[model samples]
Target: MRGSRITRLFRTRPMTHETPYEADTSRRRPTVLKALVFIVLMGLVIAGLLAAATLLRSEEGPKIAIAEPEPLAVSVIPVEYLTELDIDELFTGIAEARRTSRLGFQTGGRIERIDVRVGDRVKAGQTIARLDTRGLGAQLASSQAVVEEARSAHQLALDTADRQRQLQAQGHISQQRVDEVVSQAATAMARVDAAKAQADTIRVQIDLASITAPYDGMIVSRFADEGAIAGPGQAILELVEGGALEARIGVSARVVSELVPGDIYTLEAETGPVDAPLRSVTGVVDPSQRTVAAIFDIPETTGVPAGSIVRLKMERKLEEKGFWVPLKALASANRGMWTVYAVVGEGEDESWRAQPRLVEMVYPAGERAFVRGPLEAGDRIIVDGLQRVTPGARVVPREVQRAEAASGG
Candidate 1:
């Protein structure tokens, strides 16, 4: 009966706020809310204790400090600023003697002797070779005999004419007889002159058969040999004048305009480099080659031989506003523009970063280039280890001295 009564008390029906069941429910609701609040407060206290334990554990060990990355060490060189660059142009040429001659005998005859070989050096007036004058000796002797006989007859005629004139004066000879003796003497003297002229003609023929070098030269070729028959005007030997050399080069009009005659210039030869003076410039351009001829006279003691391949080195001003930079410092970029890694900083500060500058390569000069655009003087640029660098990267640049850079450091 008591348990039934308790069940009835726990089981309540809907009623007005003034009923006992309503009062009990209200009181229980307040107690349950308080218990729920206490449970949440206990959970908060436990979480706070756990957090404090974590803080104590974290503080028990040594602290670690984060470190920044080290800067890359690189070699750098300053941009060599310049407004002009010399464009070296080499024109191919041939070294030749100042004078070349093809020597020959004036008259046709058999070559009796050849005193000079194909490479013999001879001086002026040196007899190179001579035609065999032995065959003409008999003819010369005959001429001489005729001249001597004529001279003897001419002396006899004079004596006879003198005797006749004396006889005519002494009245021992007629005037017509004296006149005939004078005429005979005059005829004998004419015979002597004719004989002397014949002998002189033979001597001239002998002189014409011989050959002599007209200048100091070397025999470059021999077209005729001993015992070979050569005609008049046929080349017997080819001679090139020594002690003077010249280069004949063809150059464009633009290049020729930059050259001045009588200026000293250097030339490349098989032997070595030689200094030559500009002798002349053919101002007219060739119709076929469209190039003008430039003549340079080499020094006598240069040891450059004739017929050697040669070259003329000419530098023309490009008149460009650019600076010189090593090729290693240049990194190719987009749209044909090139980038260079330059280190910029306060002059005395060691903290420098790599800054990329856009440039145009105007000319390529061996290991260097002429560049312009977005670059300034005194800007140090990274040269070594280009493949390992990037823009705005921290770098420790070791500046390469000007002398070291020039020596290919």
Candidate 2:
């Protein structure tokens, strides 16, 4: 009875299924939660410290500083004023005589003698060449004999007419016979006149055999030699008249209108410059060249020879109070608008400032340019460093002097 009671008691003991380990884990659950919370708070604190350190490092980075530019060094020139400026038109031409002639023979014959050679100077009416007078002399002699016979016959006719008149007046002969004698005398007089006229024609032919210079000139060429046959209209010699020389040049229509007679021009020869004048202007336009012929009378110069190649600079008009500067000084900002920079003054700190000024081009005077602008006498211009300069840009001005004086400026 004691063993059964012990077994029943053990089986029916209420079945309480709880261990010591389980009770210990259930008791530490709140502590584990507290530990995880502490770990999360520590991580947030560490992240905040790292972000603050990064911000401090960024604030200490490198800094940038912009540098100032240096002042540019440049050269300048001053504008000038003039009383008269020449609008020169330059053209190339050849020197020619005022008059030229080609001497030829009127009568065809063999050349007998040559009196002048190439480069030989002669006066007007000077015999340059002579044709063979073999036939011409004989013809002249025959004509002369005929003239003399005609002269004698004319005197005889006059005497006969007077005699016949006297006989008719005295009635010594019949009226019919007197009339016949008078008619014969009149016919004889007419024949004498005809013969004299023929003789004069022959004399002219004889004179034509000798080729003579029509004016004072120098023989440039001899076309016929001794014993050469010269025909009528055949050129025997070429002559250029000596006195004043002239240059025949072509000018554009625009230039021609500006030119006037008696205007002075300068001709550049091999020796030097020769002063000349505008002699005449041709109204006819050359269809091929589109230009007019302008004749300039050049004074005779011993140093300059005829047929020389020369450069002619003609002054079409004069521009009073004009300024000139170098070609490099010209600058263009907008289309068809030009300007130039002028050096105004040096600052207290030794820096130069340039002022941009607009200009109008009058004309080109040789290598320089004649201009009209808001520039006064003795104004400095920036010639060398124009591109690097602005209106108010600081510059270091350096004076540039020209080698020669500007012409027509």
Candidate 3:
């Protein structure tokens, strides 16, 4: 009965908020909340410790600093003192004869025979063509007949004059009669002299009927054919003197200005190169090409032909001051200029580096170039290791030996 009464009291107390069951529930809820708070605090402390440990470990490790690369090794070519620069300019030209002539007959006539054809070589005074002299022959014969008749009459008059003079001296004739007879003889002699002059003129015309070459040359063109009537001074053939030849080349004003007569040059022909001397340079420029005409006399025409294409080569020495550098040292720049890397600084100094400088190319001779730029007189330019360097990069400059430099190594 006491147990039952106790159970009933417990059940009835659970219905009230201030009962022992409610107090126990409230205290259990607070204890459970406090335990959760302690677990969260412990977890927070562990996380903080792990983070601190990681930081300490990273600090304790060795610190590695990245090192800079070594300077690039390069060979340098010293800037040379150059007083003059040589420039080569090649010009194309056609070979021509030193002397050319268009041969023709001195008088008009019908062409009868052509002795030579085009491309036939003829010697000096060789007849290249001839005209039919049938008409000239008839005229010459008539002139000769007239001259013979005049001479016969003159001879008779002379005899008569001599006889008359003698008779006058002997008093067989008066002075007036002698004078008249002498005057008649003089008139007859004058007629003979006129006839002789006419005959001589006809002979000269006959000789001129044959067209002849003026010199040893080859016939370049034939303007007249057989049976063609040619007028006086009409061209019948063109001749080119083959012995002495020349090449006429057109060059710019600058190049022509450096050329002078009597200077030796070179002519690159199909056979080989031949020496040619400068003959003439025109003072006036050509209106169409804006270039000056230059004539060079070839030494020999053994392997050269007239009207053949050839190259005229000239090495002009320029007065501009510059320096010669290996072709490998040059770097292309804008406006047709170039760049070069120069090692500038004292020995073993940290400031020693490659500096790029602009340069103007004056001429190129084989593997070297004459250049003018902002470089000093004795600047050391980097020739090797150009591809491995950049502007302002440190470089170890090793001077190239004289022999190697000269050999363009």
Candidate 4:
């Protein structure tokens, strides 16, 4: 019991160096445990960052796809009803004088002197040329001498008849002698009158030997010169009536009926346009051309000579119902037919479809056409960008303003 008590007393005594070292180890153990725990938490945070980076590298988010192409944008125009159409037609014609004539003398003779040359203007009743009058002068002088001699013989016979009548009453001469003297006087008087008539006939021939102008005119050509022998009815000069210009145009019956006589119309001359009066129209149709001759009196100031080519323009109106659309809007279809695409629905969100309408071309004027089809007024038709447009194809409607050209030229 005493040994045990001594040992217990020794254990209860103050600590030594080894004992201090054990207490120090126990204090540092908590710090080492805290450091280990900090290292583990940092490793867990790094692991979480690595996992997030791997998820970002993978292409697992929402994807993007190319959008469908937008509908073809096109230009369009509104079509309307065409009540009537006017077609312009140009007719060819020639400018000429109102009266063209070949002038000659009434009698055959040698031309003495040509008073006028070609392109000479003359007045009515003016002498243009003369023939030799030497032969006529001699014959006229002989006729005068015969008339004088016949008159002297008639006076002598008359004196003899008076004396014989007085002698018969006095019974100195017979009545037969008086009758014979009276017969002689009558025959002489007849000869005198016949001679005078012959003289007058020669004088008239002298007047007819010369060429005179029948009216105011110009000589366009000369067929006979001075000292040229010309026969009657042979052309000596080509005379055109002066200051009277005209045009002879051949026109169709349809056009001829529409033109009224005395109405003014326009003509394209060599210089420029001129207004003239319509004179007449021959209803007789030419077999070759199937046209009638229409006479228009042209103004003299136009300076158009004969045989000059001229032009006449006219507008013909036809009664028809149709629509005018751009040529670009037309598309060829089966069996030689044409079609146009018309937009039916009219809204941004609405589905507008290209509907083809069978169209018959009434007339084509330049880049536009007048057509008749199964369509209504205010129908929208695609004009440009036609390559992308097709029948029954969905399209985006973009309208364009344009003027309707319906005139057929």
Q: Best candidate, lDDT-wise?
A: 1
Candidate 1 lDDT: 0.86
Clashing pairs in 3: none
Q: Where does model 3 exceed 4 Å of error?
A: 1-87, 315-409
The better-scoring model by lDDT among 1 and 4 is 1
After superposition on all CA atoms, how large is the RMSD of candidate 1? 22.9
TM-scores, one per candidate: 0.55, 0.54, 0.55, 0.57
Which pairs clash (backbone N, Cα, C closer than 3 Å) in model 4?
none
Candidate 1 local Cα displacement, residue 366, angstroms: 9.7
CA lDDT of every candidate: 0.86, 0.80, 0.85, 0.84
Tens digits of lDDT, candidate 1, 78-182: 766777777987789898888899999888888999899988999999999888787677788899999999989989988998999999999999999988888
* lDDT per residue as tens, model 2, 110-186: 89899988999999888878888778668768877877887787778778778878888898877887777777778
Model 4 lDDT tens row, 245-286 = 889899888887788999999988887888889999999999
What TM-score number comes out for model 3? 0.55
Top model number, TM-score? 4
Model 4 lDDT vs. the true structure?
0.84
- Ranking under TM-score, best-scoring first? 4, 3, 1, 2
